[model samples]
Target: MNHSVTLKDIAKALNLSISTISKALNDSHEIGADTKQRVLDYAKEHNYLPNRMAKGLKEGKSRSIGVVVCSLDNNVIAQMLDGIHKVCTDKSYQIIIMQSKESEKLESACIELLYAGGIDGILISPAYETINFNYLLSLQESGLPVVLFDRLIDKIHTHKVGADNFKGAYEATKHLINNGYRNIAHLNTNTILSIATERLNGYKQALADHGIPCREELMVSCNYTGATSLNENLEEAIKSYMSLENKPDAIFTATDQISTRCLVILNKLGYRIPEDIALIGFTNTELADAMNPPLSTVHQPAFEIGKLAAEKLFSLIEKKNIDEDFETVLLPIDVQVRASSQPSNK
Candidate 1:
């Protein structure tokens, strides 16, 4: 009564064994309904607390997962987190979230901390600077399940879930071209990341398919991660394109941040959307509809990606064989056309 009540204390007070008290508290079917109710009521009244560390020791799992993302400032990331949280809640599991902020050191530290914290599984979106996946490999080798989502790697053989970047980018580019924009530019991210590289390829392929030659100078890479002056960098890229003698008549940005930023930069520079330079971007931001010209966008299935990733991680965690076959799930994307990408009046 003085100290925290334990299963032993509950058993002694109720004239039952410690095992019965524990099972009743856990709602085990082996215990009678009347006895289970009595135990639950007594525990609620007395505030009987179970030793979580001891339970984890017995089960060899913490019943918790660690989630890492590059950044959560974007609407896509926020929606993805909602999806992950939903699955975790349904499964009666807990999650610890972390942000890498696109730093390799921070990403590695997050993984290490999660592993040391006794997490049963990890869901991660690799940072832009994360080139080495040895730490992830080590975690899996040490009996922890890991599922990568969004920004994944080719070196690690693990479960992955992401949107089809190639198809999305190609569709966006073709949409712009079909809208009567001949000279188009691409605002991209780091080429090392699969997301960026795949998108760039798709844009080029779309141009080739339409008999439009790919112009190297029109392609500009934006460093969203670890950039000291992101706005200045993007402004410079935009100015460079606009200053060209045969500048781009339209632009397509690869990521959510890049897309939104391009719109802001273009507006600030006095370029009219769809009239001066048509614009299309890959983003999930709801405010895209409220833009001055109603921005066109390639919408990634962020929520579905998060849900699939978490479900896959749980599958790996619960399975007996850690080396079972892994999978890479690619969800489709939707291209929403708006006034920003259309020069003609609807």
Candidate 2:
């Protein structure tokens, strides 16, 4: 095995104290420019890397963050994790990622493990089945920094970052209406999280604005943590919508997974998009444009959300105070109109 050089090795070579070497490398005012340059040059020549973990431990920080999300299978979550990794790399910090698999029990266990593992902070996107947000609250109360991203929970007040779910869903629904799609149906996750409720309300608001009566039968919440698979739940919901006396001319989905999966299910069921029924949803999949009839979508700034969330968690950790007013950031979302949502006459 290759042995890595440590500060002690550099100190011994330079015949200087470890304290002086550390101060010089850190560019402390106590160290002169000449000394700093010499230390930097020698360290570079020897290919020395600072032991961040050790130094962070000495300073009462782990220099590592815990990231908890639903799953890495989704492109949206993957993009967000990419942003987090980039920021962590730049900051000389490491990230420990864990998946909740959209289960509240599993999400709680992840948080507990991260906290017990001595992570400096946590950035979590609550699972759809999560409701006992107080679990995170207990951790925050115990001085462990906590930040919420992607799916914001109002129960715990901390630095929150996510997309504008309401406006995103609203724009998708409104676009379908403008394109002559009436009797629009909405499909969302079976959860009480703000992300779900906000999107559902957005769809309702758009319908009301257009003088269309909101029908409960036109909306369905797909169960994610049930005995059946999410695919089966979605199929049942879609079938129910089609059986309605006044079937929707278009359907608006409320999440990244739901958005793309809805499209795929529709295709598998032999339904012609835009001709049989138009479709649009909030998704950030790269395959959207390549789909047989391209998909219209409400695109969220997933990467930015992740980046900001990680940055905010660091700020909170450094501040060592969560009593101050926390920031709730909602980044704007884009409505991408594609062939799947364009009127057939066009």
Candidate 3:
């Protein structure tokens, strides 16, 4: 196996000191412009890469931030990451992204790896099975800053940025009720994440405010999974609800992907949306508009959530205390009333 090129090799080849090569490579103003250009040219020609581990050990910073998400295949998370990448690039910081695949063990291992790599900070949307707060707490105790995005543990006091899930759910449910659909079903994820709980609370609040009785049986919990598994679970939930004596007249999905699956199942079952059962979903996506009956949904600021989380994490890493005014940043959500949940034009 070919060994990686180092600064020592570059210094030796140029007959210059390691410090001079380092400064030149970094484009330090103290180094002569000609020497800096020459070093950069040589490094580029040789495809030389600095050893991040060695640099991190010497400077106490890796100039890289670690981000762990449940999955990279998730559209919402993908968008969020795009924003994070943009900001990190703008600030000349590198990012290390990891997918835990919804496993607590894998998430812990990824965190350990990032810590060992000497990351400057961490931003995470923890796995659904994440119950061990000790790992996160230990990082904080050891002076490693972490910012939680989208999902959070209430018991762990830390910086967090996400949408107003409660408000989004409330508005969605309230819209259904106002449209004269009292029997509403909520398709939610089976997890202890604060976002899911908050959304559920919002749904309940909306029902109470509208004088609609909350039915526990109407709530269906399923694990986050692939489209096939999600679709099967959704079909079962819809069938169970439709089989009930008091069948739901409307459904509020916890996510856009779930909403799409519900539409597919409804079509296969020969149920016309808004005519037989209205539908609303969380998370605004392009597919929402292209559906046979455009899906009504709550638009979340996914990119903003990522950007704010990164900004807060960097602030903490810079030795700035943000504890005095720790806040739950709630970005605004807009409800797009589409044909799926809207009253029939006929």
Candidate 4:
């Protein structure tokens, strides 16, 4: 058979009618097991692919999943995408990935294009600048399913999968405090997302619980602009922290980008990891262990988060008459110790 082999081609080759071939392919009750096996063997031999467009036209479903994220370059986001791909491919659904670069306007354009392209559903990690969920809410209300993952929003109630940011931050800060670092700084994104606030609160709670005062000047919120500006802001924040009369002895960063990038900025400024100032942050980069001092990090279960998000989205897509209540799944995170966050003396 040729590259575009069809039911007719298989039927002609097997000396069977197109109806028999179609029924066998569809696993209809009328098709005998022996005959079905014969047809399947022949179809598999010739690499037969179903015309999904035709099938979608009949069933009114494109069988495609649209995914939107801030960017596809990060190691954590890449792992999440792999999980999404694994589930979608296993369930015979195609994935279309788009990046918003943390811009709400770009994210909206991506969603509009996906909707116009007849996607069955969407799995999105909203941009940091995204404050309006009205558009997504309208689409979901109109029967287009949506499930949030990673950086989530609460305006539109639906299934969401993310890591326990509070717990991760708490553990990171607690670890630093336990190492005799009272003046611990926190580097976080300037966003209204629960991730930012929860992590910030966790850091504060850890400090309060440990009887250490939380320094207002040490809690710096970096803007979510492009990379150049972000690095500039982070450098300035670090410089200000160093100039403080009682600056931080250890630093805990929030998001993946802020975590890894802050380390680079600190090194560039000639700060010694752990000896002069300890460092830890939330990140999933494989190179964490390969950094100058082998960075400590709070690692989120990004792959599992992605898989669960897609699963929940599909559940919404194939909902039955019996409506189901939405759920928010927050997975645990791990705090991996490294030399970067060792004792201040080390």
Candidate 5:
């Protein structure tokens, strides 16, 4: 008779009790198989939806984890999410994902919303603008398990899973050096990001090891966090590097978008890969192998990073008590050499 139907309505319609309808809907062992099927079918037909919060209160758990990431436009994040999904499925948990879009305000709001939604745990890849972890620390002190991945924050002690950015960047820069590419330029993001700072440190270390000077002028910031100025900043960075009387002989890009876009822009600017300049950077896109010169890349194990972070969060969720000591899992990165960064003749 009413537009909105409840479990009480379904029970009354079927001449049953509310408890019976509830148990049937929840697939309780006490309910007969025939009754369960009937209830499920009826609910499906009538578009009956259970209240998630109420269910969580009843079971004392939401059975869901909240995931926050910077963006899904990049293939690396997509692959990492796939891995997180796989782990969640295996653990009989669900994931609610949100994007911060590289804004700290959005990130803080996402955390508050996920906590209010009663998520049992959280997995976050911090945004470039995320500098404060006080909120996250308060959540942890309040017993909410949080796992940081990829773009991590060191202030909040929690489970961190990410690629070895330092090692990856070191190897990438060394690859360029081994290939006879001296005067290597680094395209890095804002130093606020742990990934950016770690990769830059590795790049500098590699240059020092190879007896090459770390030129400050050759280190450029593309400011990828702000999409409005991303292209313009990248263009200026490239033009500045090229304008030098003794420009860099090689370029090492720090992130996925920076790596791929630099190649495109370089080609557009009439520069030949590994001829006029060598290129290597961090990227996990499938297009790497199919590029015009087949880009050499420092490939982060995105899927593995996701899977590991999910596993760690689930461990914290299922375990009765965990140690105060936190874990930092630094997964290895793979350097795939290709035509773009082949040994230079000169």
Candidate 6:
């Protein structure tokens, strides 16, 4: 095996003390510029790189942040990652990504591993199954600056960045109501995530504001099971709704996946969209425009939210304090009214 060169070897070759070589390599103010240049040039020539782990141990910083998301298969998360990458790259910081697959146990394990790895900070869009904020609180107490994005835990006092879900949902629901959708139903997710709750509240508030009574039975909660199971759940929910004495005239889906499933199920049941059942969705998915009738949707700034979260986390890492005066960031949502939600000329 080839032997690795060390600071001691470099010091011997340069006829300088190891501490002097170390200071020069670290670009410490104590070392003269000429000495620093010499050490850097020698290191480049010899392909000598300092051990990051040892340096991190000495400096109490890793220059690396851990990012955890529920699933990489999600397009929303993919866009968010692009934004995070842009910010981290500009700062010359490394990001370690971990997926929890919506499992709380796996999510906790990932957090523990990142904490043990001496990460300077953590950015997380927690698993849907994470109902409590204790684990996140523990991580904060352990001195790891954590920034929650997209999905959040209200009890945990941490900086968070996310779309204004309530406003988005309200606008989507109100749009449907304005387009003659009196019997509008909400296809809700089973998880009690803060974002989901906010969306539900928005839907309710919109209905109440329009003097429409909110019907509890019209809201169907489906387990978050990606596309396949989501289709199945929507089919069942539609069947039950159609069987009711007063069927829903429209639907406000909580996500793009739910909207797609709604279209499929409605088609399978021989229902004409807009004429029979109007639809509006949360995400601005590519398929929305390509559908038989372009589906209307509220667009969330996923990429911008991710970028802002990463930037805030870096700031927190440098400041080493969580701002107690931090308020919830409400990113703007754009409502695109399309053919699927077009009103009749009554």
Best by TM-score: 4
1-346 per-residue lDDT for model 2 (tens digits) = 9778888888899888999999998889999888889899999998999989788978988899999998888888999999899889988899999999989999999998988899989999999988888888988999888999999878998889999999988888899889988889999988988899999999999999999999999898988764357789899988888887889889999887788888888999888898988999988999999987899989999999999998898888788564667899999999999999996683
Q: Taking the tens digit of each residue's C-alpha lDDT, what string does model 5 give over 148-204?
A: 998876798888999999999999999888888888999988758789999999999
TM per candidate: 0.88, 0.94, 0.83, 0.95, 0.84, 0.83
Residue pairs in collision within model 5: none
CA lDDT for candidate 5: 0.89
Residue 61 displacement in candidate 6 (angstroms): 1.8
Q: How does candidate 4 score on lDDT?
A: 0.91
The per-prediction CA RMSD against the true structure, in angstroms, equals 2.9, 1.9, 3.9, 1.7, 4.3, 3.9
Consecutive 10-residue window with the lowest summed lDDT within model 6:
320-329
Q: What are the per-residue Cα lDDT tens digits for candidate 4 across 126-217?
A: 88898888889999999899999988777879898999999999999999988878889999998888889899999999999999988889
Residue pairs with colliding backbones in model 2 are none
Best-fitting candidate, measured by lDDT? 4
Model 6, range 2-38, lDDT digits (tens) per residue? 7677999899999899999999987799999999999
- Model 4 spans > 4 angstroms off: 1-3, 27-30, 344-346
- Per-residue error for 78 in candidate 1, Å, reads 1.6
lDDT of 3 by residue, 78-191 (tens): 888988888887666899999998788999999999999878889999887787779888987898888889887786777888888999999999988888888999998878
Task: Report lDDT (CA) for all predictions.
Answer: 0.89, 0.89, 0.85, 0.91, 0.89, 0.85
